[model samples]
Target: MRDFLPADKARRERVLAVIRERYRAHGFDEIETPVMEEHGRLHAGIGGDNEKLAYNILKRGLDAEAIRAAAEDPAQLTDLGLRYDLTVPLARFYATHRGVLPTVFRAIQIAPVWRAERPQKGRYRQFVQCDIDIIGDASDRAEAELVVATLDTLDALGLEGGIVRINDRRALDFMLDTFGFPVDERPGVLITIDKLDKIGPEGVVAELAERGAAPEAVEAFRAFLMRPQTLEFHPYGERQIRKALPEGAPDDIVAHLAGIGEAVAAARPSTGSGAT
Candidate 1:
């Protein structure tokens, strides 16, 4: 619904330049991938809710009729779809070209990704995402560096007053399982969790119930959200996580945030914390 005029486009380009420069300074290499990718790749179950929101490219030519005959499977009618995010394509790219690339590769990806969703403030079906990823580095410092570099990019753009919150997918999965949330329902549950700022905890619980989450599971998740609301921003403790999220592997998070001192020292202007 938004189109850029000459002035707008110029402004956008300048901001992108700032982002690119910061990323480059961090030793990341820029790369581009096709906007359209195989449908299977886009819906490969690794993208959580992204796979469900994939905008399918309908079948064409005589093959359309053959696919139509088996109407039960809609995937048959779609051959290609726009990528939901750069991360998936980055993984695929690394796999395909690993032989030619260095063992430790830092990456910068900036592109528009498509999603089919209800429009809301600051949320659009199509929008540009500028992402920095550290590939093939198992060390937690790589993760910390990514956050520092991204914050530096924002600082370069003169943007302030934004908090950077970090969450681990493993931790989230553990919480979901602890509450007895169905495996297939985790993705849908996550969509509501991401909206906690826009819609409060009460709203999240209601939406989860509306979406067919078990009553007990909804209650447990709601309690988990309400626990120990602290204005102070300390990386969450392992003891707190173990008692609250019994299924959680607290050691993993302890390791993940081990390099936080580097990122914290690098970007002192921003407030950061690990949240449940």
Candidate 2:
């Protein structure tokens, strides 16, 4: 049997205790879901890439060769697989137990998920994900509160330089459409741009070009990425910015980003005690 030394067990238990205490203080109700889930729902709800990363299980009575073949090709797996992430499973849980939950539900889930990937330092095929998601309310305040809670959690964990980058897909879509990018190619563009920090400008431009974006469009995107002030706006400047969005675009996205900026600004203490 695998064994844990006394000191190791004590350290692990202490870590878990700290996590539970922080989550509880933030008013999150703890819940659990099964490790095995319906393969169809998990694959569909979690996302395509995530679906590929799921660990599938074969049932009894299946031939060993068939099971081995299925394992070789995840596409052939049927009906069930190990959980990939807590969010999709949580969504399933909420759908199943909606009637008993409050209109505004704040939940903390601490569970292990399986991923079919090579493991390395700080990366694991099976690891615990601690998450807090507030559902049923579309308020920007809720989103901002989540950001604040994340910052606080990092502080409590003694982590430094933990930057929480926030972006609204809606704002991104507005930018893409305004620049004349085809709707179908927007996801590709965003995915490329999202890697800018890691791969640098030239890498992002090459990826965008490879994905069939026009040279002009790629240049425009590069320009936008270089401009930090795009997100830096006072209330009046923000009002003017919203007015600049393409006609028929959702105003709610602009309002939400503006509210988030406002909330962050308001919460910024001049003393620099907790600016992060």
Candidate 3:
């Protein structure tokens, strides 16, 4: 982590203030959660690859023999961990306080989160995250509101022309199925694909091969990935989404995202100026 001098710190706080005000204006309530959570909750499979980067806190009062006995299972030694992201803590918070909280909770969390990632430019072990979550809402309206609020916040900060890309796991699953990937292998396949930005297409194909994904499916996906790529900015809509995915894409998912785009544009007239 880097130290912020007086000027830098003041500037950062000013930006955070603007974010908080804009989010609050959108009807989101700010909530605070402990920076640490039970090690088990942090490791529960929902965290995806981030679980590995969690900074676990070792249990106290462990004797030499106890430590030796638990050596094979290191997780047994840690009772708690620094939260790698706010999502897990938010889940626990909602579960514990659901009875007292509103049926539909709109939360704004701006706090520091810790991870054990290797230090690199533009990335750090500790950093602040600004997150807005809509809990208990299953409709596409929640997505629309989130997009509108974020765009509004950016505009408030004098950073216009922000672009938001809408994607869904269902779309990924649909594409994977179209390539004949086995249902059971999709989870592992996703972990590999998450590294695509770091490993490039060839590396992804090689790793999938090493992981024993179906050869035909792997070849099909590799071919799809190797195709000539182009960047064309299209307004968020059903047509743009269809062009991005294969033919026969699920109509429901497409409509869901399209509806979100329409709702966002209706809420913020300026969103039509290439904000998607």
Predictions in order: lDDT: 0.76, 0.72, 0.88
Q: What residue pairs are clashing in model 3?
A: none
TM-score of 2: 0.75
How far out, in Å, is residue 53 in model 1?
Answer: 2.9
What TM-score quantifies how close candidate 3 is to the native fold?
0.92
Cα-based TM-score, every candidate: 0.82, 0.75, 0.92
Candidate 2: residue 267 lDDT (0-100): 61
Ranking by TM-score: 3, 1, 2
lDDT of 1: 0.76
How do the residues 8-78 of candidate 1 rate in per-residue lDDT, one tens digit apiece?
Answer: 99999999998899899989999998898888888877787677787889767747568768689777778
Of 1 and 2, the candidate ahead on lDDT is: 1
Better of 1 and 3 by TM-score: 3
lDDT winner, 1 or 3: 3
- Model 2 ranges off by over 4 Å: 1-9, 45-48, 64-74, 119-121, 160-162, 191-201, 212-216, 226-254, 264-276
Candidate whose lDDT is highest: 3
lDDT for 242 (candidate 2):
63
Residue pairs with clashing backbones, model 2: none
